[model samples]
Target: MKEYLDLCQRIINEGKWIKNKRTGVRCLTIINAEFEYNVRDNQFPIITTRKGFYKSAIAELLGYLRGYDNAAQFREIGCNTWNDNANKNQDWLNNPYRKDKDDMGRIYGIQGRSWQRPNGSKFDQLKKIINNLKRGIDDRAEIITFFNPGEIEMGCLRPCMHTHTFSLLGETLYLTSYQRSCDVPLGLNFNQIHCFVLLMLMARFTNYIPGKAYHKIVNAHIYENQLPLLCNIQLKRKPFQSPSLIINPKIKKLEDIETWVSVDDFIIQGYRHHGAIKYPFTI
Candidate 1:
């Protein structure tokens, strides 16, 4: 947790000022920021300075596993993160490929679960990885990526936390998550949990002990509207020890994850934090 706070402080001290034309909000930005979580210790890496929403983050990951491309599907499973991007994004609304309200298009889980193939057959990137991991196989290509250049224009928003590569060494499972862009105040909190939980789940299903989660961010920034709240309040707060998460033991396979898994199935223990400090989010 100190690393996260340090990253924030680094942005305040060393970040460059940049104007974002898309959101029309200026940002204090840093590049090539990275952090690691020792998942082997079972410590959940979350923003201890604020009351982070655990269910919402977990639900978003679960939705991605199920290949959900609709914002309504995200909401039904305790995640509303996609609502604004799906409904309010002007470009997505104007796109002909957008199916209806709450449609997120060909992004995230859609691409992970059913990537378009050359032969017209869909490729299940996640399934292949899971199957390989279960059999103690590491092909050195266990990756499920959400960033698809071919389908970027068909989606509501470009993926921030884009690629997750799983690796197996003996009986330990490690994760490397790559993010192209990071909204430090709001997005990093969710993304930290995403990376930790993802590694934990993959380890659980593959019968391997969870190891470390390494998160790499290309562009980390704090929006102009979010600066005061982050600097004046959040950055000033003290962070508690990282918490721990417990998953349903019965969920031992990818089928359980694909068929029916909710945020209710997961629990976080010993989460201590100050009151929630709402941060600004850009569409």
Candidate 2:
């Protein structure tokens, strides 16, 4: 978890100010940051400095895995993380592609689950990856990507953590995720857990041992309003040890994950941390 703290300090120490019109706030921004999680040891990359929302983060990932494109669906699964972006973002609210209330247009899950094809058919990237990995086959291209530049204008928001690539070496599974932009103070906490759990779940269903989850960030930034709390309070506190994650073995297939998986199926062990530090989310 010291790596997480180091990132925060790095932003405070070395970041440059950049004006962002979307949130109407300046940001301390940097580029090309990286983090690697030791999934084989179950050393979960949860933020131990604050009361982390591991369940909610898992639930959000589940919604994407289920191909849910609506915020309401996420809420029904005990994840309210999308409510703000769905209904509150003025740009999305004004976009004509927005179907109705709670419509997330064709963002993360939609792109991952049913990436549109050029010939009028649909492609299931996740299904293909799962099936291939299950058979101990990694064609060196087991990728599920949600970065559709053609449909970017139609989605609620452009995909940030856009691509997830899986690799297999013998019986071990490894994952690498790439993101173009990040709201470090708020989003990174959840994303680390998301990637770690994604690798764990993929390993479980594919009969592969979890290896590691690598995360790459292109532009990492803390909004001006978020910098004070992150740099002054959260960074000042010491981080506890990384926690361990356990997932139910019942999730043996992609269908199992899409059909009946709940956040309750995942549990955290030995998660000791300081009190919660509430940070304002940038829309």
Candidate 3:
């Protein structure tokens, strides 16, 4: 993925130093960067510059599709990404809505699948999109959104990759994902895999050929603590060719995805990459 590597380089060369409020860390930041992955061509955008944790990424997506709100649920699916963000936030720890230490509140998948309503009801956004696709009903708004402004306080962390809009052209399906903020060194690696897998799974269940997955990023930044690993070590290496994602064709329905899909159901082919880099992450 030359685009990803180039973006990293561009951030170092052109980004300005800025202080981030959440992590209290300085960042070399930029704005409004965009990229696309050609799913039809099997161009999986896993980073070859550093070892990518693709399994954890897909598992995290599955947890969201299942509408889970607990960090324990994500860990059961082999993703520890939410462990820190969920339990470590003192505000969330003190909030009454937090059911237990593992509770993630109303972030990501919880919001996408079971967005809470004021009357204590839940709306299933992913189901609606699937039903629309099944009926061939394109009203120009086949969208799945996880940005719940009203419940921002209820959630442990606000979603970065917020909205995803799916469009159809004949038998081909295209996806456009929007992210409001990104930590390029750590977050972008997983985010890319999530987008690619989302498009593939959506296309598979909806009976459409996967076309392209476009990612739009706003306020992309590399944390100052991660600059040494990213710019000095990671960026200096050349990236290998993009990997291809393999999904089980037997997954004929959306229910299959929600009910019984495992991490093994999704596979990466020919992924040759550099060793993993432990980029610093702060909640």
Candidate 4:
């Protein structure tokens, strides 16, 4: 984690910030790394330094994972992370077409489905591979894909280019995800951590081998503007800590945990008043 913090600081001290329409205003650059790994726990991955941004990020990530494209469900849950980007003219409250609406071209269902193709090709392919594996099938054709070339015109966020390769070694299942681009300052750290969490959950529910996940970032790039923030973050004396977990006494089955994944609340409630801290460093 110190290494990660150092890298973030380097980017901020040396990188330049630029604005881009796709990611709103951003700072972009390339980051070369030798290794990357994943870790899992019952709670969502978020840094809890200076009031964490865990809630909104978790809500957004879950919303995407559960196939809920619109903000209705989020709003109902007292989470409005996606409202900032909604079409102003559209009445989000009464729109039945809300579900049909696409974010940049990605529909909620598209992401939820194991495969992107309509005839269930993705699931079909996965099943075929699974059956083959059970029957001693050792073919390279067992891969599942998420990107859809045809949907490019529909305005979806380009499918997460990262792909996961699943393999079974003895009784354990192993997965590796390849991400080409990562927005370090604004979102990369959390995204990488949460995506791994999702992958682990999927493997658990599907009864796949409970194994470690390997994340590989290809052409891994970082935004320049985020560098300063990243540097500032590293300069702080304390590293972020996970919130304490507590169980609900009334509901024996339910555990209550304060999530720190959302960035919206952190920005509004935490960062607004705190002045930036300075640390000695040189490019």
The residue ranges of model 3 lying beyond 4 angstroms of the native Cα positions read none
TM per candidate: 0.98, 0.98, 0.97, 0.60
Which wins on lDDT, candidate 2 or candidate 3? Answer: 2
* Per-prediction backbone clash count: 0, 0, 0, 22
lDDT of 3 by residue, 1-283 (tens): 7788788889988999998776788999999899998999998999898899999998998998898899899999899999987889887888887778888888888888887788999899999998999788877999989898888888888889999999999999999999999999898978998888999888888888999999999989988899988867888898898878888878778789778888989888999999999998878
Deviation of model 3 at 157, angstroms: 0.4
lDDT tens readout by residue for model 1, 1-283:
7889899889999999999888888999989999999889988987788899988999999999999999999999999999999999898899999999999999999999999987879999998998899888998999999998988998888888999999888989999999999999898989999999999898988889999999999999999899999888888888898888889888888889888777889999999998998787788
Query: 1 or 3: which has the higher lDDT?
Result: 1
The TM-score measured for candidate 4 stands at 0.60
lDDT of 4: 0.45
Measured over all alpha carbons after superposition, the RMSD of each candidate to the real structure, in angstroms, is 0.9, 0.9, 1.2, 8.4
Candidate 4 residue-wise lDDT, 1-283, digit = tens: 4445555565555555555555554554544532344333333234433333445555555555444555565564444644544433234323443444333224433443444557646543344444555554446555544455665444234444345566666655566666665555444555555454445444443445445666655433455444455445535646544332221222111011123222232222222212333221211
| lDDT of every predicted structure (CA atoms) | 0.91, 0.90, 0.89, 0.45
Model 1 spans with C-alpha error above 4 angstroms: none
Error of 3 at 238 (Å): 1.4
lDDT of each residue in 47-96, candidate 2, tens digit only: 88788989999999999998999999999998998898899999999999
Off by over 4 Å in 2: none
Top of the candidates by lDDT: 1
